[model samples]
Target chain A: MNGWLLAATVELGGAGAAALWGTATGPLPRRVMAQNLATSAVCPALLLLAQGYGRPSYVDLALLMALLGPVGTLVFARLLADELLDDRPRAWTLTWAAAGLSAAVVVAVCVATGPSRAMVKLLLIGALLIGGNVIASRALAGGFRGVRGA
Target chain B: MADAVIVVALLLVAASATAAVAQREPARQALVLSVLGVVLAVLFTVLQAPDVGLSQLAVGSALTPLLIMLSVRKVRRQARAKDRAR
Candidate 1:
């Protein structure tokens, strides 16, 4: 409808398509990496959708996603450690790219929102999104060797 | 015009769902399913149902994959143990 919604649509469409393609037809490590990236991709789109719809409450979805997306990736990282131990998937470029994209989106939204509690919430989501993403990617790369089996 | 967002979300959901089903390996299928979950959450949000979207994000993103992967690991472990016992 508006610019924000249009942006959200484009982002969701592009990233979702890429994620689907990557996850659907890839080796184990690549698929895991794609799954991790999906969280980063969709979280920003959700933020944009919240702004587009003019409903701050919708941001809760982004927050939950920021929190949970990596957990899912970690789940795979831990359980599939046997399969991935050989390849040790490392996509630092893609990880940082998604992190940067999320940061940029959050900052833009915060600037539009100005100083307020909502801005703080936006910052929190952004922090969680980037931090969780990096940690998940690291785990996938076998950074925490001790956490492999459970 | 404005409906483009909805159209895109719908298409994503359809594609990801099909991908999830078409995958052969359970572990790989779980990976696709997790992506499907995120895409579905985005679709829900676009459709103006954030409440459902929130729950979907919680369940679909992490929980489903965690459960599936865990079960796969358990089954594999048990099968290996059976082989060792024989």
Candidate 2:
């Protein structure tokens, strides 16, 4: 309806399509990476949706997603450790790109929110989104030794 | 139009749900299912039901995959143990 909602729609359609495709048809490592990207991709759109709808409560959804998305990926990284051991899947380019998108969306949302507690919350979600994304990517890539053979 | 966002979200949910069902392997299906969960939550949110979306995200994103993967790991380990015993 509005610009913010439209951006959210585009973000959801593009990134969501890529995530679905990547998860549906791919090697295990790539599939796991796509799963991780799903969280990062959706969190930003949730923020935009909250902004578009003018309901700050919806931000809670994005906040919860920022926390849990990587946890899900870590579960896969740990459980599928042996299967992933040999290849050690890596997708740094996609990881960074998603991080960049999260940053842009967060910054845009923050400015739109101005200097308020809500802005701080948005900043927190952005940090979690980017940080969790990198950490999840590393885990998927076998960056943590303990995770393997455990 | 606002309806476009809803339509996109609905289409995504349908595609991911289909993908989840189409995956033959448990691990692969679990991965697609997780994606499906995220997509569904987005749809719920777009439809102005954040409450459902919130619960959906909580269960879909991490919990369902965790349960499925744990069972898969146990089943695989059991089969490997049986093979070694023989």
Chain A only: TM-score per candidate = 0.98, 0.97
Model 1 off-target regions past 4 Å? none
**Position A33, candidate 1: lDDT:** 95
| Tens digits of per-residue lDDT for model 1, B6-81 | 8998998899899889988999999998888888888888888888988888899989998898899889999999
Computed on C-alphas against the true complex, the DockQ of each candidate is 0.93, 0.94
Steric clash pairs (candidate 1)? none
Q: Best candidate, DockQ-wise?
A: 2
Kindly list the per-residue Cα lDDT of model 1 for residues A1-150, writing each as its tens digit. Answer: 789998998898888898789889867788899889999998999999899999999999999999999899988887888888789989999999999999999999999899999999999999999999999999999899875445
State the displacement of the C-alpha of residue A35, model 1, in Å, after optimal TM-score superposition. Answer: 0.2
Clashes of 1: 0
The clash count of every prediction, one per candidate, is 0, 0
DockQ of 1: 0.93
Model 2 clash tally, residue pairs: 0
